[model samples]
Target: ALAVGVAAAALLGFAVALTVTGLDGPEARRAAAPPGPAAAGAASRPAGAPDTDPDGAGTLREGDSGPAVSELQQRLLRVPDVYRDGATDGHYDAVLRAAVARFQLWYGIRGDESGVYGDDTRRDLESRTVR
Candidate 1:
């Protein structure tokens, strides 16, 4: 019984060490890469749905107000922890900007600035959510 227990412990330790080493591999590094221009082009949208940002500007920043901003807020709410306040009043305020930044950071999207909503952020969010 003692020898069996020791062998099991050694096996568990070896497995943990292997996992720790694997975390430094290329795939792990890519998965953990920070949001930036380099990460922006990593994902490609599949065919079928038209691109979300048709106008191509995809610029939604603070102080803007209207249905579009409201829609953006609604979408952000769909992402867990991205927009916790759940306010969709069509106003682009600090809260909304922070939520957008959080979403970008979480998803490794960096085509636009931290708080600004640009094509990359729009595409990534749209890809992850339903209409």
Candidate 2:
């Protein structure tokens, strides 16, 4: 059983190496990197200005929830037939994602990913909605 034990040890060592190196690839590394100056600037709003951008990171997608999601729902409701259910429940569910995608299609908001409430979508929605 010495041969089997050696093979198991080798497998364990390979697994440890993989874990140490991380298998998530370059995208994970880039995401883990600290934000640059431009990203930092975009994350901060001017003093005394309204916090119109949801979540402050300027992006929201499915599975997010909070006041920001509620605000997004309200804004989407402002546009006719965009958020028909009109539930402002603070949860970014499938309905909200579909609404966001519909709004992006109707308004030509191609800068952000479809079904995502990114900076471009937020700017356009805020500009169109009442303060």
Candidate 3:
């Protein structure tokens, strides 16, 4: 009888420990926020909805200049308090690179000043914009 009671107590203690530890774990918290209104709206809108660019990138058809370049330009534009020397012509010159580096710093992208705003940089840019 004593052994039976001890075993049951041990099981109860294990269950309580699991519940308490899991409650405070990292996965318990909700996500920070949904994606930007534009992107979220785009998905909900009808397929034929007007030419609104969902990603918050400016409206421009594919194959014009290049989607990658145009999207980068838009991301740069979205940076708050961003002061560009001139326009975002997709040139990726020193001026644009500097702007991107500043953006990287602001957005918490480590080592983003490599003069190449690749996939990681793009993801960081998008996440910041969405939030």
Candidate 4:
């Protein structure tokens, strides 16, 4: 009888371990991504937060949104006197477009009229940002 009880307990433990492990599948993980600061508090930050480049985020344009945008906004805000109204909202808006243009003009890059944060712009920003 004691042997049978131990076997049952072992089976129960195995089943539980399998259940927990199964919950970490891609679908389950995708279903559990929100409610953190990425979707909560940080989504609403003003235009003055310090940031790091989370991902390359493709090429940020007038409608893109991501941590890279946040970092760009922070870098622009570093020149407070120049970008007094820049926003760190993780979105590429009109204010960010203007700021990017100003940044491009300040760095003297020619022939870019759309104000898009492309590779050259990103490279210049990375080189010129003062921490």
Which numbered prediction scores highest in TM-score against the true structure?
2
Between prediction 1 and prediction 3, the one with superior lDDT is 1
TM-score of candidate 1 to 2 decimals:
0.56
lDDT tens readout by residue for model 3, 76-108? 777776535345565555666666667767767
Q: Higher-TM-score candidate among 2 and 3?
A: 2
lDDT of 1: 0.81
TM-score for all models, in order of appearance: 0.56, 0.58, 0.42, 0.51
Worst 10 residues of 1 by lDDT: 47-56
Superposed Cα RMSD, model 2: 12.4
Report the C-alpha displacement of residue 13, candidate 3, in angstroms. Answer: 81
**Stretches of candidate 3 exceeding 4 Å from the true structure:** 1-66, 83-85, 111-113
The Cα error of candidate 4 at residue 107, in Å, is 1.6
Model 2 agreement with the true structure over 1-131: per-residue lDDT tens digits = 99999989987886676568775677556645679986787679676765454434668999999999999999999899999866899999999999999999999987888899998888989999977
Q: Candidate 1 — which residues are off by over 4 angstroms?
A: 1-56
Q: Tell me model 4's lDDT, rounded to 2 decimals.
A: 0.74
Q: Rate the local accuracy (lDDT) of all candidates.
A: 0.81, 0.85, 0.60, 0.74
* Stretches of model 4 off by over 4 angstroms after superposition: 1-57, 111-113
Candidate 3 backbone overlaps, count: 0
